[model samples]
Structures are given as C-alpha cells and as structure tokens.
Target: MQPATTAVIALHYQNEVLHPDGKIRVGLDSDSPVRQNVLDAASAMFQRARACGLPIVHVRIAFRPDYADLLTNMPIMRGVAASNAMTEGSWGAQFHEQLAPDTGSPREFIVKHTRINAFFGSPLEEVLRIVDAKRLLIAGVATHSVVEGTVRHAADAGYEVLVAAPACASASPVTHQAALDSMSLMAQILDANALAQFFDELPS
Candidate 1:
C-alpha cells in the first residue's frame, strides 16, 4: 500500500494484556510465545512504517478507576471489572514498552477505547480520516477478539484492511489460527516476514 494513504494501528498492546506480569494474561506464558513475539514483530513493522511516513495510531482499552466506564454486560467484561484491570492512570492500562505510543510524532495518535471494536466508541475512525488513510495495517494483542472485531468493522466501513498475523495472539493456538482463518475472508492476513518486508519497502 502507498505510504501516503496507509496507516498502522496497534491495539491493546498494553500491560494489562501483553506483559508477562499483566493482570489478564490470556494464556500460560510458556504455551503462548506469540504474546511476546508479537511485540517484537509488530514493533519492527511499526518502525518501518514510521520511517516511511505512514501514520501510526495506538489504541488502548481503559476505564475509570471505579469501573464507571465499563459495561459489564458479558462474562469477560465482568471479569475485567472484577479484576480491576486496565484502570485509568494505572501502569496496567499503559501501552507495552516496545510499542508505546509516541506523543511527539505528528503523524502518531493515541485512541483510548472501551469496546471490542476499536472504532465503536473511539476517535479511531476519525483519526484515519484525518490522516487520509484508505488502507489500514492492524495488529492487536488478541487475534480472536479485538483484531477480528476491528477487521470486520473496517471491512464493513469500506477501508482496505491488512492484519499482521504474527503480531496477533490469542488465549490458545486454536483460537489464534481460527481467528486468522476467519479474518482472511474479510482482510488480508500477512505473515511476519511479509509484513516487515512490506513496511520496509514502502516509499518514503
């Protein structure tokens, strides 16, 4: 995709989800290497995307300290509230160190969201519009949840979408693979090498 019309969005790469010490570690650390691997893999692509002048938007999920902003409508949502996870101003709600949002970069933006779909309750869609993005590169901590959710929304919204598969992880291999397979029908799924190479080859 052309750099001028493309953007990269890294979602939920937060301490609450991706860090080994995260409150809601999706899976046993040993059984899910993708959790950590995805950070390095996605970071590489983000660096290239930055160097190529493509806008980078970091999306995070957080709620009020009293959990006032969260709607515990489902079991998972209730779990988040019960665990007091991703509370605002807490380290657990912060982005992962490797893919931290750059506040000083003009083309970089941070969109705080509270729903499974990043675009549902956030300015992510408007950020893409502001950046004049026609194509999007997406990477999220959980492949089966946020990644898949956002991909479907982006597709339905008419933006060309690309998912960096290596940057996506889930509670298990089965879920991860299944999500990728399902997302492939709606968005282009790119392996780590291909994603890295795509960013590296982008025109500055």
Candidate 2:
C-alpha cells in the first residue's frame, strides 16, 4: 500500500502581542494585529489542507498555572513573565482565530510546555501515529526556536519534513533565513503555496 498522506503541523502560533523590539510578548496588547503575513499563509495552508482531506494538527506552547516548573527550569519565563504570557486562560495563549477554527470543531490540538520542540514532552507522535501521518508541513513563529527544534526532532524521528518558508518568522529576517539554511539539509523547504499544491495533487 502507498504510504500514509501528509499531516500539517502548525507550531507555537498564539494570539500574541508583537513587541516593538520584534519579540512576541504574548498578550492582547495594543501591539497585536488581527492578522500578519505569516498567519495569513498558515490560514491559507489550513484551508488547502482541509480541502484536500489532509490531517491537520496545531501545537501550542504554554505553561502550567503556577509556572513553578518553567521558572525552575528555563528561568527566562521569569524575565518575560506577564500574567498573560504562556498562561492557559489568557488571550496570549489562545490560538489565532484563523488557525483556531481549523484545529477545533473537528481537528484536534496538542499542547506543549516550555520546550521549543513540540514533540519533546508532548504526545504529538502518538497523534501522528493515530492518523498514520507520513509527512509534516510545518509553520510557526521564532524560527530559531520552536520551528528549528521541531524540524530537527521530526527529522530524527524519520518523518518527512517540509518547512513553509514564508509561513514562519523569527526575531529578525537574517536569523530566520539562517535557521532555514541550517535545517535545509534535513528538511524539504517549500513555500506554503507549493505545499498546498503538493497536497492538492495527492492521489485519492
């Protein structure tokens, strides 16, 4: 039998505040935009994936209510601590509306903790196995962190990896491209539109 079809994995995309310094501070501050270019690509990718009947999974990064573990581990959580940032009930931790609808009402979402990689402490692999997903189409923020981490882990896990080049961003354009280049050998880098086209052409 043919290998299982692709499943789209969108990572660490929260409804967040875009700081003037370009870091996402994570909250419903005035810095928030209803949408951004990267999110636009993700929305389009989701629609295309659903239309093609491909499985869709969204991964979010969040912390526990007390944040006791993250504070003990990363400590950066304290430096950036806001009541909203990374907290489950806050607007900052919520999924962007566009991606939210696709992940809910039918599809399921997997949540991760402080780890940059989605699979590090999450049941993402189990979910993929449940769906028999073969390939992953990835998109998200802070290309140097969550995106980079997931790409490396997914490759090591033997999953076919595809990065949506335009559907991701980092603190800067230079770092973004650098991460892409570093992972290029390990991943098939493609634009979101190209990924959509590939799924559209999948044999039924």
Candidate 3:
C-alpha cells in the first residue's frame, strides 16, 4: 500500500457523539474503557495518517438548524430531534478537537452528511476519486451505525475497506462487537495499533 492508494475516512467524531457532556450522552458511561479506547485509538490513528501523508477525510452528521432535512419519523432521528443534537450551527455538531483536520494539510477534507452512510448525499466518493484512493481506512463512533454503514457502502462502491475496531464505539459493547463480526465478511477489521502499523508500512 502507498499513501495515494489509501485514504482515511473518520465518521461522526462530533462533540455530540464523542464528548462526555454531549447532548446525546444520556445513560452512556463516559468513563467506560471502551469509550476511552475509541478516543485514544482514533486520535492516534489520525496522527499516524497525517504523518504518513495519507488523505484524511472527516465526515460529520449534521442537519439544518430547522432540521428540515432530518427524518423525524425515524426512531433515532426522533431521539436526535428531542436532544437537539448536531444541528448545523450547534457546538455538539463540531468535530472533536483531537481528530480535527490539520490546517496545514491540503489533503484534509471535511464533509457534512445527513444520512447514516457517509456517501449517500455527500462528496465522499468524489473526494476519494479525486485522491485516487483504492482503499479506505475507517474509524468512528457507533460501531453498529456509521462505522458499519459506511464500510458496507464503501465495499459496494468498489473500495477495499479496512476498519479500525478499537477506534469505534457504541452505546453497547455487545452491539459493537456484533457489528464488527458481521462487517468482517465485507471488510478487514484491524485494531488501532495494527492500523497504524499498516499505514506506517505503506510505500511513500
């Protein structure tokens, strides 16, 4: 693998998803080992990709302030609506500081998405195409949701997908593990350290 052959897609690292004080943190244990692992792993993964000169694309879930684009009838969207999380201009919608794009890197891209799959209505595919990326290294919150959704979609779109398991979290550890197991059929699953090693070995 080379830097040009791979791009890292980080999904939904917004304050509403990763921060302890986030609006959607109700009933979630902020101090859990799983949660901490995700934060640390994802932060380190981002740093490694940046250092290796790989394109890093950050995907965020956000809706208009009026939430006109939000699907309020959906159970998850209802919860999101009630919590008022990830509104376009809200603080909860901003990317986590640790995983934010480096201002100095022209290879960094930030894309806003309204759907679970990052590519549904975003420029993700176009960006990846522009970078000539044949593979994607994925990391993010909610292993059962964004991580799985994006991986499946990417695989279907003809991109080889590698998931950083330790860099993903969900409200339930069981659900997270189950999602990872299922996704293994379509994507290669690696831990944060392994993902770092993979990128480090990529030819310059």
- The number of the candidate with the highest TM-score is 1
The CA lDDT of each predicted structure is: 0.86, 0.71, 0.84
Task: Give the runs in model 2 whose Cα sits over 4 Å from its true position.
Answer: 1-4, 17-35, 71-78, 82-84, 103-106
- Per-residue lDDT tens digits for candidate 1, residues 16-88, read 8988888887664834666668777878877788788889999999999999888888788899998989999
Q: Residue 85 error for model 3, in Å?
A: 0.8
Clashes of 3: 0
In model 1, state the lDDT of residue 122.
Answer: 95
- Kindly report which residue pairs in candidate 3 clash with one another: none
What are the per-residue Cα lDDT tens digits for candidate 2 across 60-90?
A: 7776667664644455456445533667676
lDDT top scorer = 1
**How accurate locally is residue 154 in candidate 2, as Cα lDDT from 0 to 100?**
94
